[model samples]
Target: MIFSALSPLLRSSALQNLTQQALLRMDAETAHGATISALKLGLAPQQTHTDPPELRIALCGLDLANPVGMAAGFDKNAEVPRPLAQMGFGMVEIGTVTPRPQAGNPRPRSFRIVEAGGVINRMGFNNEGHDAAYARLKGLRVPAALGVNIGANKDSEDFVADYVLGVKRFADLADYLTVNVSSPNTPGLRNLQADEALRRLLNEVLAARAKARVRVPVFLKIAPDLDETALDAIARVVLATDLDGLIVSNTTITRDTVAGMENANQTGGLSGKPLFNLSTQKLAQTRLRVGDLPIIGVGGIHSPQSAVAKFEAGANAIQLYSALVFGGLDLLDRIKRGLAAAVRAQGKTNVSELSGTQVADWAAGKAEL
Candidate 1:
């Protein structure tokens, strides 16, 4: 009840910081599970769903209360969507789910690099599979928009079939669906981002979406480590495919940017503060290639400044995961409130007004991904 009176930021600071301190005392994966469990038990404080006009925006046609979202991997099993939504995200994306259940890599798969304000995760596409998530999602309700991020089972035989199955199974449940071929932990997953493979994949995904009962929007989440040629190739497929939007640049395999930090050499995708620059640049680059297509920016967003940078770099909206690990769920409220402040400071009424305004600048000098 202590939190039932305060605004999101104040409430979060009053509660989440203490929770985070306790969670931080545990291992990263354990902390994540505990957090999820707490949310499921309704222990997290509820946040008002109201959004300032400046933060209100429609993404791929779904009316979001604000632009900030809970990215996939936070609630991989679709366990606590409403609790997360209550924690203040305008959108909550669950799972990199597959047609069947998977245990992911192994224990110790998630590491927090406090010095770098980053996380190195090789958890693979671990989840309870499509059926479980589908069941929970079907019974789930939330004020925020929900998206299901789907992936191929690590040992899946028919990759395309898995995606098609995911779409057909959950399209009716999700506000939108994300085809994730970007996670570095799944072996050969990123390879699917290549030109020919990407074309074939997106075609199937698009076709699947077309046939789904809901025909919800479909977005492609790509990796940040792509080269120019790979990016150009993926862009062609994005342009050709009737995809709904793109989640620009998943976590990175490269440590060059966060070089010399402990766990910097960890063999997993790195995300958090260091990812902001690369992912934003990649978002700008994608926007340049696929003009007018909506994009959900992810990677390294830990503050209002980074969130504003994401919108300027061309994101229709943005998602955050690793930042939440360090900043807690209330970080979503902080970023949204901060973004609204930034928008008002610029004399803007809606967040969309700033989307892609600085694409030319970031894309111009951005080093090839």
Candidate 2:
């Protein structure tokens, strides 16, 4: 009733801040559910101004109003991409949806690390199967570029087949497709990143894409926990294939930065502010290895500065989700403004010009933290 009452009120920054505080006091997953429910009811803030031209970008041939995107986990079932787009995300990715429905890990699986501005969840790609998401996405259009992130089912008989099936299911519907093999909660999923396995997976998935009526760009979403050697192998495999791009770094399992904080020992992937440095470093390393290949950076972005750091670290576009838990939807406007300022300050006409500018420094561990 309170949310319903507030729906007709002007969706202002002050109101959103109050709403965020209220949500934070609830259970993490419960609050997330409420937020999504609110979004579906059209009770969310709308971007009131035009994004400056400097923030415009073309990622893998998909034109975006800005590089900011809602990462996959936020709208796991493709429920509210349009509202998220209205809230100012230049791109919106939905689901790590599987071919079959799954209940995922047990309750209390999502934890908020308040002090560290981070969240940990073993959600295990829980989502309505392909049919549910496809039904929502079929012929649906939104202003922001839409992407579908697909994953293999937990009980999948053949993981590569699952991915191939996903490619066929979404190729015609999405502006892009992301093969997500990085979620830590899914048993043995990260192993797919291994060079040989990755090569096989991409080969099959791409083959499926080639058969689709629409050949949307396909990107691989990898984990941030990999070392330089692993990054090298992945880069080598990706470059040798017809894969369109890469989403640099997903939620991390390591928690070195949030060690003493509450929920620090949670047995799931860590995301939000603490993930920035490691993910960016990995992104830069991937950039160095695969020159000119597009990369969408995700993880640990909470402010405009952090978002800009992603581009400097070699992301052609960037995505965020956990930050919204703390910063509220207003963060999107702030980031777009910050990016526009960054572009003008650097004397660049477009934000894409900033990509990889600091990759060498970041990759070598010389970037300012």
Candidate 3:
């Protein structure tokens, strides 16, 4: 009611000025921390039954109250999972943590392209070590599904050993685990996305998972920057290894879409609005290649419409990070409502029913619009 009454005024230049002022005063780190804190206090305990059921998704034997999740990088140290899970995320994936702690890239690493409603971050894998992240996860009380994102330290000569070590130490604590071989920020990290490297890494990690008697699902996070050949190769590798699901993408190195923005030149993986189409397209291709395997679609999801688009593109679940930075906690509820409505409108019973439903059209380039 208040929003309706102020609708006209809200569209005015005054409101835009005020909004910019608010954003200008907050950096990404502060914004992310504050938003997680609010979610912890405001939405964590809310009943899921109060929201639409169509928003829920099941992944790796865990029932997520909603398909919406917090992607890797936000809680690099695993400090905010409980708060984030409580805040209303279906799941929270923490870290990109390496075997040992290392300072990420130099400052000015995170840049907000307010004009484009996007962000670019090259904060390497700056994280406290696995032990630190594991300690924090050990104390989390939230009921939401939780996953840990593991990565190789930037300077490690034995990168594969770093990943194996991560699985040995943190896999036991995670409901699931993600091998982050896709982050473009860390030097030589993206190379791990190559078929041979990924195959070797997954083999070792799976062995470690078996050794720990940890039957938890292991998913690989890939880069959206891949071409058809690379993606196809990745699919083959996943199939050969019999690994679990794939997080369709991490972030992209492409800036063709947001080149007009002031900070578009910033180095890092680009995310948010600029990434939506590319990521979804890649997701569609992945779904086609992988057949029935689950894919977590992420990147540029700021609204329920985008979330549904990902669902239509073949994502079993969806994740968000850049959106919260731009839209605030209210965005979660809005996405939930919008996704529920979209699902019902399509006459779908649950989100799972809609996965890969539009792949043919998406692949033909006819459905994206």
Looking at model 3, report the run of 10 residues with the lowest lDDT sum.
1-10
Task: Estimate the lDDT of model 2.
Answer: 0.86
For residue 108, give model 1's deviation from the true position in Å.
0.9
lDDT of each: 0.81, 0.86, 0.78
lDDT of 2 by residue, 38-63 (tens): 77877777887888999888888888
lDDT digits (tens) for residues 54-90 of candidate 3: 7667787887888888888877888768766755778
- Candidate 1: C-alpha lDDT: 0.81
Consecutive 10-residue window with the lowest summed lDDT within model 2: 1-10
**Candidate 3, superposed: residue stretches over 4 Å from native:** 1-23, 30-50
Number of the top TM-score candidate: 2
Q: Judged by lDDT relative to the true structure, which candidate is superior, 2 or 3?
A: 2
> Model 1, stretches more than 4 Å misplaced?
1-19, 366-369
For TM-score, candidate 2 versus 3, the one ahead is 2
